[model samples]
Target: MRKTHLLGYAGFSGIFIFAISILLLHGRQPEISIRYDAMSYYVYGQLGWLLWAGLLGLGLGSLALAAGLWRIQKGAYARVGILCAGIWGTGLLIAAIFPTDPKGSWDQPPSTRGMIHFSAAIFAFIAITLAALFIAHAFIKDGHWKPVQKWIVPVTALTAISFILIMISIVSIFVSHGAPLYFGLTERLFFFMSLCWIGIASVGLLRSER
Candidate 1:
């Protein structure tokens, strides 16, 4: 198979593994509320290894997509997009290495490891959002990617909006003093949108001529 095709398959496989891991984790850890608790909290559960695997899948998938796009795209915008995507992948890996504090522990001061994990998560989200924007812009300029631009641009917009909602939910949580504000839901939406964008781009790469 071609290199791009391999990368494309890797991207799909990684996402598939992550999705499966999430489903399994949810089923195994019934105590964890999907709506109120952050996904990172899963790391403290009995099926914590599943969460680690899921994070690794996401991190590897992102890196694979970035590699494939970097090989296809050129110029300043493309370069910047690729860099941001790389950062997103790196941040995910960092987050995986450093697990967040226990659930409800946010009420107290964050631990050093927890702070690192939170920072990595934030950086990953922001980097991926920028990656989608810049990459979509680069797609608009490339004839080979023009067809994908139509699909990716809308997903990118939704990703950005979801990210904003996530920020608001986080702020509400903080201001309300650990009150539940659907932060998990908003965060899931952002992650889902971002992953959708990555899947679309990976499919585009798969269909592109070598």
Candidate 2:
């Protein structure tokens, strides 16, 4: 397969993964002391495979458009989404490498797991917002945002709000000094927000392919 097509295929799968993530997070928060062992395993199940899949898409799309964006051309809008996707993928890899079992002692008070999760979220949010701003810039210049690309704006707005949300989540983590509830909500927010941007990108890419 051609590099673009391979990237697009992977991009398509990555978008699907993001969609699954949304489904994963679309519910009420589980109670405290309820270990996420099952969900954690599921998260690992998808995450372990999908991170690499996402990398292919992010790598190709970002490289293809980064130079153009530097010159203020189109598809610059995608650069941040690509960057955030790459960072989210990397963070998943890292978490998988050194995961904290939900019931583990470290998962309790002074949550090392929460810290790791929160920090990764901050990075991811920053990347998503940057990408969205640029994408919006491109979208505006061309006056070509379709119905699907329409999601990009709200997704970006959420991406920006997540910056604040993640910060509060982190602060709440610190204040509570490792409550599982705070940590859990943080994870849900971060994961779903990521899904939003990833889905937005997937929609754009698939539409482009069609």
Candidate 3:
């Protein structure tokens, strides 16, 4: 619970995720991604590095999140954990659309993004479960509050609503024709929401020090 330990561990995790995501994406992922074709190769060659960097940000953000959760109330941690898992897990559900198709043969390439997304979901789920256990430990915590209603209720609702959006895209992928891009804005939004939540949590944890 010491400020230095909380911040230090969280900060280290944040940096580790950020760095590894980048290295995995650029140092290795693009080569695997490029076997699709000349065009696909060109695109990956150019932007795969960038996407890797973005994933890096997500990883670091998660660390900050884990650290914050370690400090916050058990209920708050659970809320944030679900928020994170639901967000990142949605990415896997989206990416699942790939790894298939007539134009892109089965031999095309491998995408670690989906795997990475899956791992994040599992981690977030575990974190939340632990938070829940902590919640059951003797009840000195606040019972309920209106501000939680104003923020947690609304944000959780938004996350739930977004699930419908994800379902639509899933149906569309099976029912519709084609895609102009590797991914879509909706997937990005999922991660973005997760990032916003963790980033907010990190700030709150940091601020609590004042």
TM-score leader: 1
Across 25-141, the per-residue lDDT of candidate 3 in tens digits comes to: 545544443212211122244444444444445444454445544555456545555354334433323323222222343234435653454354445434433322333221223
Evaluated at residue 162, the lDDT of candidate 2 is 64
Q: What is the C-alpha lDDT of each candidate?
A: 0.84, 0.48, 0.41
Candidate 3, superposed: residue stretches over 4 Å from native: 1-47, 75-151, 177-183
Worst 10 residues of 1 by lDDT: 140-149
lDDT minimum window of 10 residues, candidate 2: 29-38
Candidate number with the higher TM-score (2 or 3): 2
Which portions of model 2 show Cα errors greater than 4 Å? 18-81, 104-122, 140-145
Tens-digit per-residue lDDT, 28-145, candidate 1: 8878887878888888788888888888988998898889988888878778988998899889889989999998886888899999999999999999999888878767766665
Q: Residue-wise lDDT of candidate 2 within 1-210, one digit each (tens)?
A: 434334435545654654554344323323322222223423344334433333334434433333323333335445554555455455554444444344444435536765575465456456655666556655544433465566767776776776666567556644565543345455556556655655545444434433
TM-score of 2: 0.60
Better by TM-score, candidate 2 or 1 = 1
- TM-score of each candidate structure, all chains considered together: 0.93, 0.60, 0.49
